[model samples]
Target: MGAWSKVRRVFTRDANIVTAEDLLSLAREDRLGGRTVHVTNDSALRHSAVWAALRLRADLVSMMPIDVYRQVQGLQVEVPKPPVLISPGGSEVGIKEWMYSTQFDLDRAGNCFGIITERTGVIGPDGRGLPGRIDLVELGEVTVRAKGPQISKYKICGVDYDPWDVWHERQYTVAGFPLGLSPVAYAAWSIEESLNAQQFARDWFGAGIVPSGTLKNTSKTIDRKNAREAKESFRAAVSNGDVFVHGADWEYKPIQAVAQQAQFVEARQFGMGDIARFFGVPGDLIDAAVSGSSVTYANISQRNLQFLIMHLGPAVGRREDAFSRKLLSNPRYVKLNTDALLRMDPQTRAATIAAQINSRTLTPSEARALEDRPPFTEDQYAEFDRLFGSRSVPTPPPTAPTGATS
Candidate 1:
């Protein structure tokens, strides 16, 4: 009992620590239409357009394989089986799944976290505890607590984790905020509006495809129950454009309403574009209307380049920086290989490779490798040297004037 008390005292007592407060309590909540917009992965995914945009972005980042390399002198070369590259979080799931899940959280909530598990004592000089498993923690379940001297601690899954034990990648933040603000949270109002529109559509369509109208029975008095019964009977019988025969006394009149009053189609289309804009995704990319035209891009390559530059570039950059800082030692870095994403027409690709080789930016062998061909053999290498080894550049023979050429 005495020894246990002594150990407890050692952990509890601190020289400068005085108070602690949870950051969530201090956070300024953002609300819309008298309701707080709670942006969780589930809630954000409710809107099909928003979900499509997020899925596109998440898959774009996660599908790109991560390559780790060591920089020696001026050249960087690939390294195999780096600690972080191995099964993330000590789980059987490979890095691909880990990255996909993390990116989904990051895109949905504007933040992602991983709890590092150090299994051994061979820590690095900077105290990056030996390459350990990284377990992903849901952003919704994490809370920040402030200690004195500007230090922050994390409460994850109802358990306290020292800040050092967790890696948090946040999208944005401001002064006086202990937690990083997520893009989804920032655009919560737009997402909620889009969700509401989708829900309205489903509910409206589920009841009946036709618009609401009034039914009349001139011959017999129609009671409330009878009216309801007649409406149900009419819906069940002729909902799908089936023919209906009624007595001369029965009359059906569709409500005369302009689309301006309903505005269902316009509202839905607008919501798709608004939500897509918030996510930095092209509306047309997610099957949304593009200027009332089906044409979104001239070709697939142009669309891909636009997506990479506008949407995926910043995302990829953020992950690269975070991984480099948290998972690698000095002179070692992580790279997301996006070569596969930059596809082009065969003629264009060949022309681009030729230009690179001619400019000396890329070697002939390297271009061949890009095309999935093996390196040059000894004989090929000798032939290449024999042709281009001299200082003089190769030139084509001059042609005579158009009509005189023979």
Candidate 2:
């Protein structure tokens, strides 16, 4: 048997394989000084900022409707969606869920993988059959082996799969690298800092690492035993939420580290922006305050358009290319309709549509179709004519002036 086969056999037989926690523990021990909260795919998601960034991208991408099209005589025509696009992971998982899962993985890990559960008779240019059903697998469950700039093997859940049988999409790729670089890995330091701050705050409040107040007997000197007793008594009373009444000689001062607490809050805010940058999401989109920057949008549509063009557009295009190549035959391609992202408010939409119709760029029926309304019926046209006059009116020819006749 080959080396990988033997390793696979061993993994199959071994019930207690090395877990992520085990690796994390090892990593923690090897930290080269400073606060190193080793971040993995699972641990990264626990951070609220990371979760929000990933979710925002994944949710938006998944919710955008996907369509298939073909080039016909230099004009693009919409085609019936393939069964694979409708139900990528078979009937159990629809396109929305499949997209969300894959996009989430892609955002975090920079790669998403799936197994080709079924294929159609159509052969792609690569001579491989087009995938009909692709069941996504968790990033942690699959191991990829690469040779130079190309992936050589994929071992998923102790089973070996050929590269042709696997569906892999990648982003943030660099030259000479087979696998995509993970954002979670690159932003580990920032994620770790935020996680540590959270832990520190929890410990500060929950574990009582710092005393809330200091009690001093200003008028008298007390021995160690007396002082200890007094301290215990004060703590016991405070623990029960009772008032500790004492003479004027006993001074009580509350230690409220307002500045220190504010520092933690500031660090968390900065971390949120930093994480947002790593994931290509605008800070304001996820409610992260951007310091020293004032960006205003005329409308929400403009903001969404900026995001689509600057950050999410390339990724969406990459997905379209991948889908087109793997799921469709020659000359047929896939498109993720981004119009949903750039939807305008009612007033803006109406004005824009009116302008388009008046300019003859868009027909009234097409504008109505865009709003999910059917074309105007004969009765509706009659009602419009009754309300106004005939839409078409002829201009009378101008009469030449008698004195300035040509």
Highest lDDT scorer: 2
lDDT of 1 by residue, 272-342 (tens): 88878878788888988646566557767888998899888887887898778767776677889886677
Cα lDDT tens digits for candidate 2, 1-406 = 4432433333333342422222223222245664345688898888998999999999999999999889889999999998899999998999999999999988888788999989888888779778989999888787766545666678888898989999999888777655666787667778887887887687567755443678899998989999999999888776545678888899988886556554777788899999999999998888896778879999989999999999999999999999988889978999999997888999999999888877778887888899889988888888877888764322235878889957
Which ranges of candidate 1 are over 4 A from the true structure? 1-40, 119-131, 147-151, 208-261, 292-299, 376-406
lDDT of predicted model 1: 0.68
Stretches of model 2 off by over 4 angstroms after superposition:
1-36, 211-262, 392-406
The TM-score between candidate 2 and the true structure equals 0.78
TM-score of each: 0.69, 0.78
Error of 1 at 136 (Å): 1.1
The 10-residue segment with the lowest total lDDT in model 2: 18-27
